[model samples]
Target: MSPAQAMERSYATLKQMLREGAFAPGTRLEAIRLADELGVSMTPVRDVLHRLAGERLVEANSREGFHVPRFTEAMLRDLYEWNSALLIMAARTKRPGEEEKPIAPLWEVPAGADRIAALFARIAAAAPNHEIGDAIAAANDRLHPFRIVEQRILERVEGELEQLITRGSDQPHAIRRYHLRRMRAVPDLLRERGEA
Candidate 1:
């Protein structure tokens, strides 16, 4: 593979592992070990680490190497609030060029985290601002692991989403409830993973 390809592969693998809670917070992510684990060169590992560091997914110290952030319950609530606001913003903002589709009846599909994500993505994409969508996506990257880790939360909120789509009630209220499900679910999940 080319150097860029190697970097991309390593970056994606590391990101997946992080989301899955494969590494605990404060665990040292060494370049050589990770390169070997991902079947890539140390160069790609370093490059990916730099990118993750930029995203605040990992912290780099000159002496201590990269560390995962200790994501606390309060921080999780803050993210939930930020995410809820984003959904509200998206629901409120009118997309300039795109004609708004009536909200999809998402309940027809089998419910899961991915399905919930697609639902939220539809809400987010309606926003006229590309920057808002991008911010939502960036937050999603940090938040995806929680979705995977606790699929039940998404499953639990399926009815709220259906109501949002079917009744066409206020969009932000339903979206806030959806975000709150994760906010409520994270504490137990973090404790289960011993990351709390």
Candidate 2:
């Protein structure tokens, strides 16, 4: 395989392991072992490890090599705070008046709401029996993609809003208002999901 393909495969495997709790926080990831398991060369595995380190998913230890980053309660709280803010921003950009709508129904199934619900259920069930750090890490793994998608949507909306504002259009404000409503509902959704 090409170096890029190898790197991608290695990263994917590592990421899966992290998400599944196969590699718990602070667990050292040996390059040779990972390469052998993934059927890739050390070069690609090393590159993937470096990339993961940059993303804060893995930490580079001078003496022990790369290990999964450990999470603190404060760190988890901060992550949730950031995630909530970003979701609000994204929702606001999509349809500004979404806040006025009752948030409870917004989290109903056949939508991203179900995914959130499932994630929280997983977290809740795991939290009591497992380490808090592990639960938080798993939650982060699940929530990260949703945040990424939200950011992408927010970026697109911002681009359009910019152009509309330049044209002195009133539609941008209305759109933003709707999005704010939707964004405001996010916390409620999270709460519901967490409780489920």
Candidate 3:
């Protein structure tokens, strides 16, 4: 394969490993060993590693090369908070009479619902093994629509959330808490529908 293809493949492999917890957080990626394992040259592996570092999926250390980025509990909480705000923004934008309505309720009515249900089924069927890890990795790859919906919502409420965050508004914590509660309900919902 070409260097570019090699790099892309290596990057994808590393991403999957990270998502599946194979490359656990804080574990350094040994370039030569990784290259050998992936059957790619070190150059392409280096390129992919550098790219992941830039994306904050990996961290660069002068002494030890690159490692998966680690998140503290507080950092994880903040990430969830930010995500909750974004999700709310998305749901609101998709709601009727919302500005422009990037995602029409009608679109999510039939096909979207089916698609989401299928995803839930897959999630439910994932076993606690390598197969489950693969499924989770694949699920991350298929999150574009969900991410787009989130981005659309965030775009609308960006200014407000930014202002609040900048002004040290405590509302994000509350919003975050609300989202956590709602997220907890998801598993139950899926179970009720016999999807889980």
Candidate 4:
């Protein structure tokens, strides 16, 4: 395959491994070893590590190599708070007197983070401002990794999302509460494993 394809392959493989918790947080990654593990050369692994560094998922230093940053309790809570604010902003940006599209009832919706994300995406898209929708979409992608770890939180959020979508209401408190609740569990899990 071409060099670009090799890089893409390495990037995807490494991203999946990281998301699946293959390496504990705070572990330093070696490009040569990773290349051997992924059946690629060091070139693609280096490129992929730099890309992951850009996403803040991994840290890179020219002299010291790559390190996976640990997610702190405060850091997780802050991310949730910021995401909650973005969701509220998306709601507030809606034009006045705009009629909301009908949404499915709570019982009809499926459980899972993807569903919860779709619900938020729909709510954000309802805003007349295109920028609001795009911002929400980007944040949702960044927050995707947390979904599997926080299934309980997502389950609670589904009902709140339904209320927001159907009634055209801004339920920032509900969103923030849902996030903070999940924040409690993540820190414990990460800390117990010495990953935080």
Candidate 5:
């Protein structure tokens, strides 16, 4: 593979691993070790880390290298609220001559975090503003880890996601309630992850 391909491979791998919680929050990511594990050179690994850091999926410190960000309760709450705001804005903002699209049936979507993420993405895509979609996508990446924790700790996660998918992008109230449930579950999610 070419150098660019190698770097893209490293970036995609690291991004997927981070979303899947392969590295715990606050764990330092060593480029040398990751390069060895990824079967790529350290240069690509370093570049990938910097790119992820720019997206806020990885935290970087010049002295300490890169680490997965450890979320405080307040930080998580704010992120959830911010995501909620983005989704609500998307729901309310429709482009001229844009028609509403029907979401896939709940059964078609995988349960848990996947369902939640997919629904949110569709809602973001429905918005007229591409920036809102991009923001929601970033928020999805940031919240992916916590969403996995919520699957283990929070009750009715699947049902809640089903409601959001069913409600579609027209109801800002439903979007607010969906995120509010997640915000309320922050404590449980933290406790389950032993982060509290």
Candidate 6:
């Protein structure tokens, strides 16, 4: 593979690991180690780390290198709120002169963290503006770890997500409730993850 291909591969691999809770919060990411693991050079690994940092999926420090973000309750709450608002805004938006269509009711869209994120992205894509979709994606990347933990802690997560997907723009209240439920569970989530 070419140098750019190597970097892109490294980026995708590391990003998936970070998003899937492969690293514990605040765990330092040593580029050399990752480079060895990914069979790439240190340069590409370092570059990938910086890229993930830009997405807020990883944190970078001059002295300490890169590490997973240690999410605080407030940060988690804000992300949840931001995600909720984005979905709600998307629900209320319409493509100019485009006829309204129900959100594709793909009820078999898997389950757990990926399910929720995928469903939300689908909702965001309904908006007239592309920026909303991009913003929601960023939020989803940052929130993915939390959602993984939440799947284990929260009750009836799949049911809530199904409601959100099935009702789509017809029930903005469902979107709010879905996020609010996670927001309220932040304490328990943090405690469960030993971050509280």
lDDT of 6: 0.84
What is the C-alpha lDDT profile of model 5 across 110-159, one tens digit per residue? 77777788888877887889999999999999999888888777778777
Cα deviation at 148, candidate 3, in Å, is 22
Pitting candidate 4 against candidate 5, the one with the higher lDDT is 5
Cα lDDT over the full model 3: 0.50
Residue-wise C-alpha lDDT for candidate 2, range 1-196, written one tens digit per residue:
8888888878888876655446645678999998999998899999888987876778998888998766544454456554434333332343334334343442343333233434333323322334443444444564443333443344343343232222123433543453454355454433332311
lDDT of each candidate versus the true structure = 0.74, 0.52, 0.50, 0.70, 0.84, 0.84
**Model 5 reaches what TM-score against the true structure?**
0.92
Q: Give the alpha carbon lDDT tens digit for every residue of 1-196 in model 3.
A: 9888999899989876654346545677999999999999999889888986775567899988998666544444454455455533333233234323232242343433233323323322322334433433343333322322343333332333322222123433544554464344444433332223
Q: Which is the better candidate, 3 or 4, if ranked by lDDT?
A: 4
Lowest lDDT sum, 10 consecutive residues, model 6, at 94-103
TM-score of candidate 1 versus the correct structure, residues matched by position: 0.82
Question: Would you give me the overall lDDT of model 4?
Answer: 0.70
**What are the root-mean-square deviations of the candidates from the true structure over C-alphas?**
3.0, 14.2, 14.2, 4.0, 1.9, 2.0
lDDT of 1 by residue, 62-153 (tens): 88889887778898778878988987888778465533465555555566555666676777777888888887876776776666666643
Q: Candidate 2: TM-score?
A: 0.52
Scored against the true structure, residue 28 in model 1 reaches a CA lDDT of: 88
Error of 2 at 169 (Å): 21
**lDDT of candidate 1?**
0.74
TM-score of every model? Answer: 0.82, 0.52, 0.52, 0.71, 0.92, 0.92
